[model samples]
Target: MATVPFPFSPVSCAFSRQTGIRRSPLVLALLSSSALLFPVQVHAQQANAGAEATELTEIVVEGATDSASGPDKSIVAGRTLAGSKTDTAVEDISASVSVITQAEMERRGTQNLDEVLAYTSSVSADEYGSDDRYDWVRIRGFYQTSTGSYLDGLPMRISGFTGSRVEPYGLQRVEVLKGSTSTLFGLNAPGGLINSISKRPQAVKHGEVYTTLGDEHVEFGTDFGGPIDDQGIWSYRITSKWQDGNNGADHTEDDRFYIAPALTWAPTDATSLTLLPSYNKRDGNTAHGIPYGSGIDPKTYLGEPEFEAMDTIEKNIGYAFSHDFGNGLQFRQNARYTDLDLTYESVYGATADPSVSRSAWAVYGNSRRFVIDNQLQYDVSFGRFDSRSLAGMDFSYNDTDEHRVFGSASGINIYNPVYCGLSCLTLPAGYDWNQQETARGFYLQEELTFDDRWILTLGGRFDSVTTESAFPDSGLSYKADDEAFTKRIGLTYKVTDGLSVYGNYSESFQPISADRTSLVGTPKPQEGTQYEVGLKYRPANYDALFTLALFDLTQTNVPYNISTTTQSQIGETNVKGVELEGKFALTDQFNLTVAYSYWDAEIVEDGITGNQGNKPQLIPQQMASIWADYTLPGEGIFGDLTLGLGVRYTGASFADNENTLKIKPHTLVDAAVNYQIRDNVALAVNATNLFDTEYLSYVSIYDNTAFYGDGRAVRATLKYTW
Candidate 1:
């Protein structure tokens, strides 16, 4: 019944209020477009040369430079921004980072974020099986769906089921930073975070259009970008896609429409500003799995088609600004505002019996979030010692409102389900609540390099978080406030010209919502710590990179459900793992990737549940994958042809915390083939789960539900680029 103060103090309250005033979805749309009209004047430098000789000479030079946020033209990326928020070389950072470029995504024919990360080390994509609602991903044995997602180095905060969904086609690359990251980015899971770089306008002209056809599926998309003026003062890019299909499941639809427009104004090489706006809509059905050991078809639809629906609409607008003072100082700012609306309804089997009793549920929700980060970086050199210092402050506010309902549905036979309309269901009024959360953080980082051989990094962050919830129907309210400081330190040594070894220690802090009523007063925030050591190698003679990592991670104050209404935070978990990843461009015509991970996760302490020392549910001990692609040259009768193949293996895991039900291991295969008909046209075919292997991707004993992995799916695509 007591109210808590907001995280922003009086000094910062006015700033927060100004941000809250621009919550209107319609107003944001207009503002996103109007941003281009007001352009500040910038001075361009002129160069003059004098020749003393009788004969004068003229020279012309052309080249392109790579940035942390730019497109990666190759599959093997040597530098990344996600590791340190700067354009830092991968080998110099004292952490494990994996990058998946557009080239790799195209070669594998990835359709979703899950498929894009399917072959990455220390990552488990599609952990919840065939679900159209979200991209369920787990990193280092911890779920990251709610906390560890980012775009353009900014957090994509999600409350409940309201979250932003990304289009893989619009991304230039995906970077995965493994281990605790609160020292750089506040409020995150210990397993690390995934940062996706958006496709931006290019100085050169390029465009591509493609169409894909498959069984019960069809899609069309295009991406084009170029300079808007001859002097290259302005550039623009537009990416759009439409798809209609199903995920090899009966009575389910997977349809989406996505478009993103980007514009950049760079009057000078040192100063640049870019605007990124996007809209996405998805209409599909909820994922309802069959009962465990029910002997029913995996593709069978348990819910009534007439009453099942899951749909979402999301809009986002953001900008990135940077200016270099040319005095060993630089400033950067990034901000984004996101709005999401979701509607979900389903009737699923309630028991594992032959006569399935069904339960109906529906959720209607809306979420809005605004986040901003400002950074100042300075570089100074003193003799043999060089230093790069970064200082930043970030703030985020999230507001969510939801209405939930529950009812009973008529029973159905497992073998043959008789269709029934919504009239046969009994419904009642449900609870409605509104929740708001705010977080503010100030961080500082220092990177020191001595003689260009040894690198040392130190970072610290202080965060203030607050959460408030109110139940309009019950006239009850709950509030919680938390503050914490996280820190990180690392050191890297260049062993040779092409090899390096590094070690790091980092920490994380996450504030939980107040919806989970705590029996022992307010719930404490979750804290995580990790220690990691890794080795990286990049051959100077070839395009290849290899990495090996070992980490020990622990999370404390984990919450567990004590009852239907109450929870307790007397649990702790520890995960130790080893990962190996390699990317190789062995020759001009061959590319290969290999990844392997082994995780040993255990519940170290749980006073209430009495399940201590047991393995956590749904976390595998080992996962390995390999993918290879080759192109063959022919002078006659055969054009340029490419072939690709991949194999993935997921190890066994437990279904419940008690370790009673063991889920068996499974292996899957993926293949692709492409032929270049001409210089500007090509055709390709891709297949996933080539053998149609049937295995359980997830099992919930408490809910009496089990989901099957995706089946064999094949699609053919024709593309033209100019």
Candidate 2:
């Protein structure tokens, strides 16, 4: 789940201690690693210990779904919801799931998948204006980049830590399913999983445009979508966006153009299909800023122009379909094809020099990926039990070839005179990492309801993966095949009106592969488990929902090459946490939403001796966020004005398991004001980090060093509808 280096400009702040730990880092890593294998989960019977003595509710919230039976808009009716229910007892398969609404995305002006998931439990996404459009996000103590992502329950393309990439626009919601999910999905990382729901056909006609202006030649452009037919059988949406700006730091300029077009067709009452096509051409100079070891002050952090960051020219085409057979069954399918041409360069120098960081040879790579997912579901009744059953399969192939070249150290340049561009041309552009991988998988799941009161869900999956990387040293290639099976089981009970409780147990697996120059033995398939329980309450006659959940997760058989350094989870990991999220519409003009999380993660094994109780890098123990908005109900223009506020906080963390380095905790506040110019237009201004607060969080690690997140940023937008 680790992300490759991208175009992030660190503030001039430097903080970390090279001081050695009194105990062995390996020992501590191992002890902590064991935590990944053994976790204490919360179950229905234990609910009273975590909170009050609670029972189950009668109804649950239902989100939008396509089926042969068509679609229905039914809100929650005082029952346990899908996101947070804890009743039937197992482990963590009943884990909590959080959804980021489309409304929230616009308020934050999020440009990609990475930016959109930032405000969730167990999620830490850092996008401090690095060169690449892609983002680096952490969940449950593991790095989840392009590799650890999904679109509508299907995997996307992901390679190792080389070239950088980004997600496109036109998404309805980003759903975060915490903990192991291989039970229904297949071949996954243990940290957690992400499911991106694309924008679909709607009966209503809707579309919008947005424009923005900021500092350092900053600018923005956007266009939205709605309905395209009278029968409401067809729908279309388009997004056109462009950005040109200099980051808050030096040598950082974000420039790009993007186009996304999506369509949905409902030829019959029982069939629906959607097609999405996207293209993006991003050209910018790469950025390599100060490493955390130098202790550079983020305030003084302007970057050198020498390192070539991420230069990628890409295209994406995808299709999804849903069919309702009318026998209480539905089918779904998703497919995506991608093409990528990218080049990257790096400058490695002593931490002290602001200018000569490029000392070694430059690195570059090129790749392409194709993936397809198909699924079928059936809903039926058996005497006292009603069920929704699913069967699915997945397949993916990646063909990537790298080009690397050597360059002289004296060629390093820190300014606009031009280093190599982000993505290509560092050395001679022919150097090779030389690797390829292929994988295939299948899975099944079922949700059962008994006497309209007891609900049970069960699922399982299997995956086959093969990897090959060649080493030029001995003309030898190391290869490995990883095959695994995972399962999920949970129960939910509706014991009373307006309340429901649930609990679940889930498992996951990750395959292994080797590169030619690889010395890491093909590891056993990584294994993961999750246990969770929670309560959901929705009062009748009120427009509000509340949920509280507790979860414990662990992963073992992780990938590691003792010959080099142990990455995020080389051995085992244990993550336990509690989360609370709610939304309240107090009145016709006032609304509020709050999300809070507490996480405790530790490494259980490192093959070394003695490092335990150490917090995982980038995985803060405590995190919280809240937002509110209110509109004045008046007779004139004053009634059109709305005000909003948001805040997020994180606890302190150690940069590494050895605790040789440390990062301070921080909080951010944002304020917003909006006025409706008329019925279809509005102007909004937002001030983030209004106090100009300055701080840094962990990004990634190499050997014994750490990197930080971005500093303060502010943006405003003008929107119009037709």
Candidate 3:
């Protein structure tokens, strides 16, 4: 549909020098970092190495005393900014929050965002099976694909099929905040939201280069950053990656190219500004499914190789600025603008037959978005009482244009299919439309503490949202304007030196963005309410944190898709769940994590649909996972080895809202092994679904289609760092 040229030529030159062959722009961009950035020199051992090591140790000790560990680099993060726009201890937040650090992601060898969150509590990843197009995730029985994603505290909200994708390599840490959060974030889902912290400039110089090889996959990447001058007033960081591979399906393609360059200007410690800009391109195919009980190979390709395609392009520029006025008061602002385009086409079986009945479809969409948030915080103390007050405002705007087409494809026998190419497929124009939305919110919050043992928090926000949609072919247009106010209150009491109990009540509001005529009539904004209580404990003798939480969350005026072009907002749902999560560093070389979740979710009210008291589709009521990593003492040969293991369990779920079909439960195992080849070189191998388990990841009774879970996957990586 739409195209943009590569911004740099060094990427192509460097790639050609390494591979000895010319390739697409994607491959060229992957290799360009070395040419643009200064190269690192490796030194050999010298006779005075022992003396140099002693001197280095002293420097490290001095640096450690001057600065504390940041949450992005620690395995067990203790502080987070997602809960309150300010840095606060996780145990005192009065709500459930989970953080996945960069070190943890490396240990697990996560390849995508879904895998990065596979072991999180109250999260369901890969709900639609092995799809390379998007990361399908749900939190607490509620889908969050359209509204629950954020980057650096700014919303990455999506409309229709125009969504943004994140590159895990460019992230420092991922934080999950559970329950309603509209009081501070403006608009979101009731279940939760995900915030990804971007990798920024570091005071210390660091650089790494890595290559990975796996089944039908090859990749190369590099990340490096440091001070730009001797005074250290300016610093810069750059990250890039390129991959060419395929998913579990046969005759499919999965290729991507991504790069992010960041710079920070901190003239003084009190004021700082950072600019972040990135570009990403993806080339893949749409997901395909077979009929239930078909006994067909899961990797079978049902679409025409020449006619099937899915490509997306995204570009972004953003900045974060903050300043301290020197008196217990601070000001901060964050903003981002994004442009995204997508082109997708697919052909799949339309009926359960040995000679498949196939249908063809295509969609082309483009979206542009801009979001900004500004905050002011004041901290002061009076006698035995302390207070931290926060006031902020945020604005978000999105514009989207989309076109769809559908047609019929010639039938082919599943047992022995023959290739017909593009001549066998035909598609006609279907729907063409444009939509735009704008939202503005203002919020205020206050946190009070008494005697350093009891804490109270109160927050409220008022939001105004406007949406407009137009169909060009039909000459029809509709507009809606809505306003809402949401509030949150919480209290926490310290029971012991390292234990605390907390309770909270919060609310959320979301405006509908679909066509009014296609819907029942005028649709009202969805509202959500939640009541939660939780316990948090951090051991005094060990580096560990444990949490237990129970919550009751409800959402009214929920919308459901009646067809590809129509929807209705006549549903109300409720979910009551318990979640337990723990992270422990048992010893100097051992780490363990455990998580479990149980949900009782039901459709409480439905007007148009007669089946009301049923469980929502594709939501597992029970899920659990555990991971452990251990490394040997690095004293001699074979001492630099490390091992990791994990297991995940997902309980059964219904295939549809009517609950007529049940999908069986499944459990999968993952493992990793790593060895330090040299002081600056390492090798690692990781495997997921080690047993090659075969089970259903999703099923849709309405379409009579089923998708199989991913099979065994293995990857080996070699990395060099300085």
Candidate 4:
């Protein structure tokens, strides 16, 4: 059987079948935006006749390869460039890295970043349960929210109430680089960073239209791309999604709309320029937390539903340009500018009081950011040694304006609900706070290879960061400035074509949170170091990669105390762990992925006696997962059927720094089935938490709230491609 690329995708708005809800305002806006792009596409098609005709073969980067399959190919492949910012095979990179390809995300029906990385090794996602506001994830026992998240290798600056929410459909792949990355990138966490690669235009035309139906929501999406000119020098891609539905929790809505348009222009074989633009709008309510002693159910909604909503609108525009000189020398530049707006208002559970009365909180914010990076890379060989050197500099600027109000709101019963008008609540007047942060960095790296076996990498960076905060009402201001130099070294020895052993030593520095509330008078930045060793195996004849890694990391100068009277930084943390991961395509019809991790994370030193020597909250000691998929032979009338099964296990952990409250461990099961109706059409059904096991996703000490993980739910998808 021969498979063709999916056809021109049409934007869709899939409302709930049960509720018959209409399209959201956000969707309407996206549809209007789509209307504007179609004209340009039409013009491109018409201009192809007048343009000079030429034949240009597709240029494949050294380590970037496309298998026989289309854009949505199988995940078990052999090439990736995320590890080194250069075209390099994953097995050759010394760091511990994981690549989640688009094919895997589509096969698993991943709707968000959290879901896409759920089964990945050394990653913990959805720490706050099933919230749609952010993709909260931890890497190697450290938070990645503020320090370790990037888009296309550039750090995404998020301050106060502003965040960047990416649409999964617009992504080509997600790369997780474990261990300190300050050596190549700027300041970041000791655990590592996640880089998301955007979908770019392809010389070959492809498109898909799909709709997903779930327990409480429906979503429609499309992806299409092809050459815009007869000479194939110009290509374009457009992707869009619209969804409207409720979450499993009562009165919580998950509505969103997204669109991304990309264009590529290759005037010559050695040079190319691409423009990427995206827009996203989200209108959803925050997931509430329940008190431990409260009789309220985890799925119950205690807030005034009609008066609660967290809405956000964001836009991003960027361009990437690269040109190759002679003799393996290249120049590349990538830049993006973003604007974000958020409006959030909610009444959440405050106490265990059965009456469920609590204070209402509201925040309205606007933010703008700009980031750009440029690099020069050269590949050279002398005798038996090969050297690849890279030099780059990057800068970023961010500004945020926020208004917040906290006031009392009338409480309602969980079992019996009553509508309380917004008039019944009290709100503070005026916009009260503002913040801004700026950062710049310069870096250089060199990779040297000996014979065909030994590889050595050395890199260093210098960074400077500044943050400012103001309170309009109090007439107070705060400022912090930091500068640091970091370095990293790694060596890899290839034992054979299929196996390699590698080791690395790296360092990291993290400045205090830019938010005025946490800036403590130019305090010393938190510093960390790590030593890691790993083995990677890629069977020559099989489409599989297996990895094993062990590492020890320590971070010091943590903020030990923060009070109005005094602020001090005297704390330390240590994390030691081992991880194993494997993904394989045993045969044409069978695929499997397995991951396991064990971590010992503890507070080595702290000002608070009760917290010292305790395990960090929410840092589980053990995690493991396995997924297997099998495709059944196609019979007479039926096309083909693929069934997938997965299991995930999480060990117990402390709910607070004091380690008094213990969260019990739990196991979950997930299953999926895909039935191909025809060569270009298919239906898929996926379910998570199959047994409906209820477990705590997060336990907040300050809020005294417990949030539960997602319950059992099913999603069915119908897709058509050409």
Candidate 5:
């Protein structure tokens, strides 16, 4: 967790909680409204800080033309808006963006966001081979949990039993916007999106504090920030962490606690405002796959170590605002509110027989969400052309309440036995229904730039959604609504100053579920379209960034389920891809990152004629990865060293859909090291499948289960900084 150089525009804020020591009345009204808005924003920043800094100093010099990394400071970034929400660059963005920073997650000691997108490219995070409790990714080949995910750019309300668990050291970067963004993010998942960002408030001061210990884990963390005075116009940050471990499966337990806090105030300098709060909790254990030629032992535990566990808690509070109204126009707003809670009980051992029978379940969930967005940007011109425009609106609401209780425990011995206890399973005296959803959107965009080497982009969006349900033990109620409109277009051609060439076309929509009407009729609305072409290279010398992309997407009305309450929008799917990425530093001590992807996802139209052209289970028609790091060059106590290495690959697919359960291909290797025992301490070590590779990270085929992929774990860290 390291960061600095933050001058606003990381738009978004969020957190709240209380349980055993008070707090939580919405975290005491968000800590009494941030202590009554912190002295009224420091008395309105000392009463208008000198007539708003002399009339906003020409609107801060026209907001420095929306600075797109003009004064180069590197961690590999040439500006971004996750591919055009404004701040362009990223080689003019025609698509396929991927950023990851915080110094590449502290030189790959990444811990989640699926190990910070293990080598990126078409991504395929935690493909379930262990490490459960959320964050399962998949991009170019679909399944981004739900609607692709986001944070600094809003949208992070998932459901099944609620979701969203971040804390990758409270992130400071992590983009990955790869295809069909629903024209400025409306209903998504054409395999793209994963924003994150957050880790704001900075005016120089920095910090870090860490502790981690391996093979069964243990953790502690802190990340600090600066200024609240000295007139840096108030700034602050805080990111916390605490963890307890054991994820080598057996008797699994993995606890956690996280916190995030932020603040910013800039009373002038064209205004700014920020505030964020967060809290997270977890106590994990869940993910009992196993039953693929079950020779058992993938860290076999088969559940039941005194009634297993999987608790959760989440809370967030947010804010983000911008101002700058000096002739170039600008106004922004962001919001957040979230709450989630879940409890799960387990009892697996689903197969390996023993007269087969061992499955108990329990889940009680709750969720609440509220989101918001508002934007308006301008930056116009005419005379050798130049422009940047945007308009926006967004809203979201959510409510989910769940309940499930099933029983039938006791059935051990896959090699060993276990004794039952929770009264041998039996729990159900209440709860079973609730759901609510709401959404809204309106978007517009335009980017245009001509003489400076052509760049054009267009966008559009309009959306509406609603969902409601209730069934308190069968008292029934339901509702639905829908609407959509999406579009996007792009073109780029810088062809110089570090290359660029691009093209794009996009659209996406998702609606359906209007009171669930479909037995082959009335529930239309999924939709997608894409076409892309790309090339970007930021070489000139080094500090690197490279890319190449080609794509074709397609999706349409997909829905299936034919009975038990009917569903059937028939189906359709397609994907065609290619991607290559690179991130290098090639010198100041070497660094590198590479990624590759292929993807061919099929199922082009199907109502079930043998699943029409199949090939879409776990998507992976190739993937690749590489990573490297180096540093060495000592002085004093022989310290200051660094090293890292990585490798990954995936291919092979079809775990069913009658594509005949094939699942093979695998590769893995990872390592790391760090030392620098003075200058504020350091010492690190990391490893992941450094050989104990077993493979099959996920394969279900309707619960014929599989999951394995995490072995040779190791960790060791100790850091302290200023």
Candidate 6:
């Protein structure tokens, strides 16, 4: 295909600063007061960007060789760039955004977000996605949750312990941005973030469904889609899933179910809109780490499962909306109303001593949250200079209403350890609690790109939050806090055709309610600053990209205690690190992606050890992964067969910041095979932890304190697409 470049001139919101034509002095609702909006721009491309247009491609999940079946290629459909607001190539975005294509998930038989990310370098998710309890992926060592997530540029979540599980079948792609992102974005954690582009109306008819299985009793899931119109203006997609499974080492079980629906509207050639409404219900046990004491050999439990002694449940409903007003103008609104009835109780040593583990009291609670967000933006033009600016406000008020219900029974009757297997009985009862926490925030951001080759970004935000507790007739105990404004700025320069260089400066402020007063003390805001430099390279001739980065960051004012524990420098620390990533299509039928990272963190100014040195618990100093697939086209009655392989390596880590406990590094591998049966149907098989490796995610004992990684297992999937 000859390169077709639709290059345009640079236009910006610059003169507006003096003319004040479209912006107001007061940013009414957005938590921030500034935003960078890019409403218009020109053409883009290249391997090394030598004037050749890049080929657009989609991943194959059904293992089909025909690259003709993808959302973007549909006769009638719109597109999105969730990683950036402008035409910035993925390799030039400054921030690292890991792209998880829909094909990648289907190819791996992924049932959850964690499964798809397992093979991604720089990403480590909770071992299983069987339920909502521990399905989180860590990027650069920070947990990616509601605080680190977005759907079509709108906030997708709000808390960590309680984040939403997006079904793999309902997304066009998953983009992960590493490092501080206070610019062009609002209130967020400095640990990095994830953006999920929802599946929308395709203006055409299209859809598919696939089911999978594995060890630990794992089973059930399907994803399907289609059009809702003939004028090519609307479309709809649905995803549903359920499973009963077990994680390795503790006799554990993963069980849960969920579903989601979405609608897309494209009224004309220059504009588009999307709406998504989702609901999920999950119930399952958590990872059973060995008790604090009573040393036991982790080897003896290698085949054991993390027992389901503890249980939990969750329910949520939410809607997301996004509109692109051609010419660099856009807007978004997200709202959610959630009511949860849950009960959590842990039997300390269910496997070691069922009686003692079961005897522990269970704590139960019910929680409710309501959140709404609105943001607006417009892109303008300037004669010699062009800038993408955004000015909008967001108000998120979470009324976390929680109350304790009662306590549950302990593990008893099974005094002999022999009964600890799946045969164990007489599990303990559960309990609940009642409490409430409220938080509100406002923010804004702005970005400027010169000649479409250089970008500068700036932004800030403020927040107010409170927490309260109520136990039956004891009235209530409440605490409130306010934080200072946080700021961030960044720069990116196109160094070569497919590569760019970038640097950033950012700050994060946290407000905690430890003072028991309206605003007694703010704990100095846990101030932090970072210095980083990186290279993003996407070869001009092939479908491949490589990235290298280094950074130094420091954090202070971390709380030391739960109540009245808001102290400054009690846990001050410094972190420095390096990272590398690459994605490429080896051939017309083969593709591969790889990533690696190294980090060094320590307490620089803390009470624990004046200047104690130790890596964060469960945080490996080194991590790497590779995923590749090969397919044979136009072959047998079975059709093209695609094979996939993945491997991961994790470095040493400690169980606590004190460095009292330690764990050595380990490696694991996975495999998969896919074959087409008919023009619209395909079959697949997937296996993880093929070797059933035994390694501890963290230290639990002197001789045997590690947890199991995963045991070997397999499942077959049948999928049909139109």
Best by lDDT: 1
Q: lDDT (0-100) at residue 244 of candidate 1?
A: 97
Best-fitting candidate, measured by TM-score? Answer: 1
Give me the displacement of residue 75 in model 6, in angstroms.
21
Candidate 2 minimal-lDDT segment of 10 residues: 11-20
Q: lDDT of model 1 at residue 455?
A: 95
Kindly indicate the candidate among 4 and 5 with the higher TM-score: 4
Candidate 2 residue 132 Cα shift, in angstroms, is 6.3
lDDT of 6 by residue, 441-520 (tens): 56666767787778786766666555454443555454445556767777888877667899877765444333434322
Clashes (N, CA, C under 3 Å) per candidate:
0, 74, 1, 5, 7, 71
TM-score: model 2 vs. ground truth: 0.81
Deviating ranges (above 4 Å) for candidate 4: 1-72, 354-357, 514-522, 562-564
lDDT of 1 by residue, 473-499 (tens): 999998888899999999999999789
RMSD (Cα, Å) of model 5:
23.0
What TM value does model 6 have? 0.79
- Model 4 weakest lDDT span, ten residues long: 9-18
TM-score of each: 0.90, 0.81, 0.89, 0.89, 0.33, 0.79
lDDT for 35 in candidate 4 is 39
lDDT of 5 by residue, 550-587 (tens): 89887777776555466577677787878887777655
Candidates' C-alpha lDDT = 0.80, 0.58, 0.77, 0.76, 0.73, 0.53
Cα RMSD, each candidate: 12.4, 9.2, 11.3, 12.9, 23.0, 12.8
Model 5's alpha-carbon lDDT is 0.73
Ranking by lDDT: 1, 3, 4, 5, 2, 6
Instruction: For candidate 3, write residues 138-245 as lDDT tens digits.
Output: 787776667888999998877766665678888878888999989999777788888988878888788899999999999999988889999899999898999998
